[model samples]
Target: MIKVVAAVIRRGQKILICRRPEGKNLAGYWEFAGGKVEEGESKRQALVRECREELGITLSVGAEIFRAVHDYPQYSVDISFFDCTICEGQPVAKEHSRIEWVGADELKDYQFCPADGDLIEILSRGQSGI
Candidate 1:
């Protein structure tokens, strides 16, 4: 299984989400900015690195909000989702096609990857119940 890490990066009342670039795996689907976790690195470390590389920002990893094992026909992913805060730099689409900051209520409007859809639902539920 491929180990991946994603940040549920938040600022004020908005959460950051990115659209996958065309011609990439799961292209055009909206999801959090992240990448595969490399060998010997903790999930948090991978997430921080990925945010810097993919979004041109630094993140301070926070709580682990969700984890899911997703199976595709070609491969599988063990995805770890974390709550994060921007430590520095403005977000830029270094790897994604685009980026947007959406409010919790607006999350349902976007088309996200299956695993990410699950994550959004979990986050939305948590926010609503609080």
Candidate 2:
């Protein structure tokens, strides 16, 4: 399985989400801002690195809030969702097609990747304040 890390970066009552751009796998699906865990890197390292690369911000990664394993036709992922904070710089759409700050209740309105189903449900239900 491919190891992935995701950040649930919260600001007041809003959480950051990114839309995958066209030409990428699972394009148009909303997801937490993160990417794959590179070899020799810890999960937190990957989270911080991905946020910088994809959002152009420095991230202070927090505790793991959720985890899930999902298999798509082409691949499988073991994703760790972490509660994160922005430590420096504003978020820029460096890699995503669009970025949005949405309340937990609004999570259901957008389509998400199949792997994110459980993570979205937990967040939308206000289970962890993620």
Candidate 3:
């Protein structure tokens, strides 16, 4: 399984999320900011790198808030969602089509990536501080 890291970056009452750019496999699907874990790198390391690469910002990665394994038609993934805060730079849509800070209750309004299904459910259940 390919390992991945997603940042649950919270600001006040909203959380950061991004939209996949067109031409990507899951174009337009919203997801938490993160990317694949590179070989020989810890999930935390990948999360930091991905935030820079994908969001053009630096992050202070925090505790892992959630973890799940899911199989897509193309491949399976083991994903860890971490609580994070921005340490530098504002998040920009460098690799994504757009970015937004969405409230927990508004999460269901967007069409999210399949890999994010579990996390979405957890947020919807009001199990998280959100």
Candidate 4:
């Protein structure tokens, strides 16, 4: 299984979400900001790195808010979702088609990867459980 990490970055009542760019595996799907965990790196480290690389922002990763194991036709993934704060720089869509700060209730309005379904429901109901 591929180990992945994602961030639930919140600003007041809003949460950050990114859209996968065209030509990507899940193009146009909205999802959290994060990526695969590299070998020898902790989940937090990978999350910070991914936020920087993909969103052009630095993150202070916090508690794990959710986790999911999902299988796509291409592969299976174990994804860890964490609460995060942006400590430096504004978010830029360096690798995504776009980025938006949406209220938790608005999450369900966007199309997302299947792996994010359960977490989206939890967050949309304002139940981070952190």
> In candidate 2, which residue pairs clash?
none
**Global CA lDDT computed for model 4:** 0.94
- Candidate 4 has which clashing residue pairs, if any? none
Candidate 4 segments exceeding 4 Å error: 128-130
TM-score of each: 0.94, 0.97, 0.95, 0.97
RMSD, each candidate, Å? 1.5, 0.9, 1.2, 0.9
lDDT of each: 0.88, 0.94, 0.91, 0.94
Per-residue CA lDDT of model 4 for 1-130, tens digit only, reads 9999999998888999999999999999999999999999999999999999998889988899889999999999999999999999999999999999999999999999999999999888887464
Per-residue error at 42 for model 4, in Å?
A: 0.4
Considering TM-score, which of the candidate structures 3 and 4 is the better prediction for this target? 4
TM-score result, candidate 2:
0.97
Off by over 4 Å in 1: 126-130
Candidate 3, pairs of clashing residues? none
Worst 10 residues of 2 by lDDT: 121-130
Could you tell me how far off, in angstroms, the CA of residue 126 lies in candidate 1 after the best superposition? Answer: 4.3
Alpha-carbon error at 79 in model 1, in Å?
0.3
Off by over 4 Å in 3: none
